[model samples]
Target: MRSFINKKVQTIKPSGIRKFFDIASEMEDVISLGVGEPDFDTPWHIRDEGIYALQKGQTFYTSNAGLMELRKAITETLSAKYDLNYSPEKEVLVTVGGSEAIDLALRATLDPGDEVIFTEPSYVSYLPCIQLADGVPVAIPLKEENEFRLTAEELRAAITPKSKVLILSFPNNPTGAIMLKEDLEAIAEIVLEHDLMVITDEIYAELTYYDEAKHFSIAALPGMLERTVYINGFSKAYAMTGWRLGYCCGPEEIMREMIKIHQFAIMAAPTTSQYAGITALRNGDADVEAMRESYNQRRRFLMHELERIGLPCFEPFGAFYVFPNISEFGLSSEEFAMQLIQSQKVAVVPGTAFGESGEGFIRISYAYSIQELKVAFQRLELFVEELRARKQV
Candidate 1:
């Protein structure tokens, strides 16, 4: 009992985002733009479907891979929206959430000391999951000049003989950047050249703001279907976060491996949630469209207000967040976020929490209501003006 802790368990740091959230919670009059969650409740029809499932006494586990009906719905949705065809029987796996899907994929594929390449300022889980799987986490920093899109050159530079996987998250988190087809083509060339497996998180695929830029999956590209694992869910699109249901589709061999991990660890996702997810895929297209339009409006409003208040932010094309440069305040990102929350009662995540490249920025989510956004902006304006008057800007 003197010293029995596992080295891997002791090495992981607490999540920086959660630490700030805990502090922000203790503050009074705070308007949080921090969390990366959709503000909308799950659409009524989907909720009704879940309730109906419960009433029908369908609470038992269906199968480890999830209900065949839900998998079929997922396959259809993927084909209709992303032009990706995954066989429902052999190539799709329903998971507890995108988080669990990611964990299962990593566990299924990685061996100790294998290297996994991922971009910086990404969703926080990638590195930790890789480390927990005893894989090396190689982070490639995405530049602000490139709109935080991972470049082919950067990816190629990161790959080596030990590299086993690449994790790509687009309609990205924290920065709200999206990769276009050309950009994806360039990346696909590198992946093919290196013969590396890819796990792409497209959770925000439907939240794209620019009508001209459609979301394209790497798996949909030539020669990539066999090498890429596509992960997505109903959480962001249908505002079904609490449902905790997501799915992964890939080559049958890869999917079969991931299914083993999911089966052993999770057994099956919630049956009622699977029912609601089927409804979301089958009949909730209008709900997704409405939410996307609303988020686009909020995205534009936040960008305009942030720029008007003299914060220089990269214009985001997808997702529900804005990453604004805050370096002029002459404070580290953490300092600025803490000061802003303490002085202005507005909560935003420090960019440094995402990665080192995010040091001069802070991420503010645009998922709040219009009125709340306006109020938050007003407070931000006042706070900035006060800082500038005291020569802080």
Candidate 2:
């Protein structure tokens, strides 16, 4: 019998984050800070909307582009939140989550051997998605001293004549780093100079804390709207991860191409999810505000506790995760995470799961309840103390 795995598929390793999560699952009394999900249940009002849609027997598939109402809601939200305007009919494509949006964007735009430039310590999907699309991924490592932010110089250095797209995720995953307007302005200059297409994932746009820095969309910058594909979803802000609904907005030409792929692959986003997403957009502002405030509180608490435990973490400006330097522990990120889980029953993802630049750090999510966070922090403190007593730190 012949082996059947594709050569490309065989080259990809399974997600490092998921590997640890599987290990953590079998351990007794484990308190996980590993997953990057909101702990809140989907708000009752949104649930009622889904239920009402079901009760009305409205289970048919929506249009390939999703419901016009939901698309319009997204258009208005984009204008209100980011000052970027997009047409609901021609410029928006609903997807099965930001994950699908990402896949569609890369597939529609890339040809084999095309280069996609993105920063390291980002969401894990970018490299694999690029590879799946037969695009080459060029990773620009962000510096720890710069708080894991991607600088314009780094962006400029990463681009080559083969560069087809630049993938940017801010309010970043695992690192909680966000780019300020000035930083984005500098990057916008580089993008224009290189004539690069930009795919920006701003799923955590509403979760910004610390500085009052508003989210800057590359599409909103000069000469960018025509070349930028903006991706966002209700998962982080609306606490609707299970809804599996997200959308992409961009120039009509690119959006139409993305829609062609989506229509063929997915048909449309979930009908019930589209309906509930409308409610999430129309009346979920208060819920988003409340959730953001709670997350900010937890973020501050986690930063303080990590520092108190001798883990010097950069102050995160967005997202619900903190990446703390654990180099003092004299263990690799994976080893530290493994020992922490085994000894203290506390689960956190090794920062190296994000990228090579994250090797000396560990990512702890603060999306849990305050009490649960306190318990985890206490365990972590003890674990660090024990390591120090053993001459590990």
Candidate 3:
């Protein structure tokens, strides 16, 4: 029976982030700053649209690529916001989530044993998706000194004849690192030089905190449109995680391939969510602004409190997490997270959950309310003090 299971699936490790989360779930009074889920509910207008869809009996399957209207909205939104253009009919695909878009992209592009270059401390799905697609996962370690941004030199060093695609998530999870326009320009040159394709996850683009450092897409750069798959979704920005709707736009050839996989595998995205997504793209800007502003306030407060508590963290300008150095206490990242939860009843994910490069840190999410953050930090202070005192002993 064991031999009948796909050995490749067996070889894959369960998500490290979920390891502690599962333990924390069984415990009482645990304040979780672990998962990257938004604390905000889906905006009222978006929810109303979904309800309206249901009332109108719009519960049937949409087109394999999704409703033409939703695809048009996605293309228009991308063009208006990021100067990106795609044909609604040929170049866009709606997926179950940004997660599914990633899986489809890998499956569509990767041949057996083709190497996929991706930075470490990235979203958990990347390596696994590559592996499941029968592609080789080549990890390039991102340095804390560089604020975990993938450098051109690092990318160039990772590429070889076998390299086919680069999986990038900016306004990154775990690290909350963002690649600015110039940073992307440098990487684009390398991709062009290497003739590599890219699947960029920009789901957190709307959560950027620094007004001066707005998010930019690699696909928008020169010579990149033909070689990049741009993935974004309603989940993070619109707080529609449960809706599980995301879209990808790329060259027609690539999109056509991805759509084939999505058609057979997922058939179509949810009808209600697609309707809600139309509303989201058209009328959810103000709601996004409010949520982003709230996250920014929490971000600043967490940064200040982490610094005051003597945890040196890289200032993350995007997303809703802070990755803080926790090496002074002489514990592995997993051990530190485990002990923190056991003794302090506070839960944060270990940095190693992202990659080996994250060994000296832990990711604390700031998506919680200011009051919840205050309580969590108070517990963190006491926990750190005890660790220090134990070290002295």
How accurate locally, in lDDT, is each candidate?
0.91, 0.91, 0.93
The full ranking of all candidates by TM-score, starting with the best, is: 3, 2, 1
**Per-residue C-alpha lDDT of model 1 across residues 1-393, encoded as one tens digit per residue:** 526988887887777788778887998888998988889999999999999999999999888998999999999989998899989999999998899989988998999989999998988888889999999999999998999999888998899999999999999988999999999999999999989999999999988977786888989999999998899988898998899999999999988998888877789999999999999999999999999999999989998898899999989998899999989988899998888888999999998788787898999998889999999999899988987888933
- Please, what are the lDDT tens digits per residue for candidate 3 over residues 317-345? 99999999999998999999999999999
RMSD (Cα, Å) for all candidates, in order, is 1.3, 1.2, 0.8
Off by over 4 Å in 2: none
In candidate 3, stretches whose alpha carbon ends up further than 4 angstroms from where it belongs are none
* Residue 350, model 2, lDDT: 90
Clashing pairs in 2: none
On a 0 to 100 scale, what is the lDDT of residue 354 in model 2?
87
Candidate 2 — what's its lDDT? 0.91
TM-score for each predicted model, relative to the true structure = 0.98, 0.98, 0.99
- Model 2 Cα lDDT, one tens digit per residue, 1-393: 226878887888788889888988998888999988999999999999999999999899999999999999999999998889999989998899999999999999999999999888878898899999999999998988998888877887888999989999998998999888888899989888888999999999999985666777777888888899999998999999999999999999988999999988889999999999999999999999999999999998988888777889889899999999999978999999999999999999998888888899999998899999999999999998998899943
Write the number of the candidate with greater lDDT, choosing between 1 and 3. Answer: 3
Q: What is the lDDT of residue 288 in candidate 3?
A: 96
